[model samples]
Target: MEASKVIHAIYNDDDVLMHAVKKVKAAKHHIEEIYTPFPVHGLDKAMGLAPTRLAICAFMYGCVGLTVAILMMNFIMIEDWPQDIGGKPSFSYLENMPAFVPIMFELTVFFAAHLMVITFYLRSKMWPFKKAENPDPRTTDDHFLMEIPVHGNQQELHDLLAQTGAVEINVVDKAH
Candidate 1:
């Protein structure tokens, strides 16, 4: 198979890059990817990307954390060793649930946050010791990069990107 050609359009400003994305989508071109120096509001919607389901995963993780908290508190306070917590020897998990409320809340937040981070990293194919996939290093600091696949109309695409105020344009063979 032949190597695929791509155009990397660099933008100095996020507003210009956003406008360019709209124009490119209006022209029915497929944008492969975009890299921005910072998070741009509404960029995902502009790119027509599906909403992420990470929130659902977070909710599930929170539920697991809550369950674990309940079971752990029950085992430690009621089953394994019943203690006189807060001058009340309520040897019942349900009776002492009010005291454990803070613990449950903390554990739920902790699990949701940590699990979401791990899930995001795994989903993005990022792992410890993995090389970066950024096409240009400037995108991490002061530039935005838009990657568009070349489909035998490089000149037209270049013209369009130039019209959209791209600071620089590069044609590269994308390595898989």
Candidate 2:
């Protein structure tokens, strides 16, 4: 494999990072990635990334959970073994629907929360025991880092990053 060079520009403030991203995009340089301590609003739009579909996925998962709850409740209470409880006969699912509402709601939220987290982890390629890919530890604390691949214009890219309020810039050779 060949080793490629990449520029890591460290920024202190999120605002500076956002402006730097816009300037870099306007200059036609492809930004590989950006890391921040917390979610930066409008960063995705500035990076020209597509909107995330996690919300839609969570909705679907919730629907599945609701269906499961309904089917399970029907089988257990109505079909499998019907019994009278609290003066209400479990002969019909519709009659006992009110009693099942808590279970349905709980299962829906549970599935949506757990499955959405799993989906996010899988989509991000973050498997269990995976090595950390963060280039700088400070990004996890209070700093922001922008990574851009060098395309034989190191000097130009370095000068531009410096002009964009980067606190520090380093060119590192990355082996892939």
Q: Candidate 2, which ten residues in sequence have the lowest lDDT sum?
A: 83-92
lDDT of each: 0.95, 0.96
Candidate 2 C-alpha error for residue 94, in Å: 0.7
Clashing pairs in 1: none
The TM-score of predicted model 2 comes to: 0.96
Number of backbone collisions per candidate, in order?
A: 0, 0
lDDT of 1 by residue, 80-120 (tens): 98888569885788788888999999999999999999999
Superposed Cα deviation of residue 21, candidate 2 (Å): 0.5
TM-score of each: 0.96, 0.96
Please identify model 2 stretches exceeding 4 Å from their true place: none
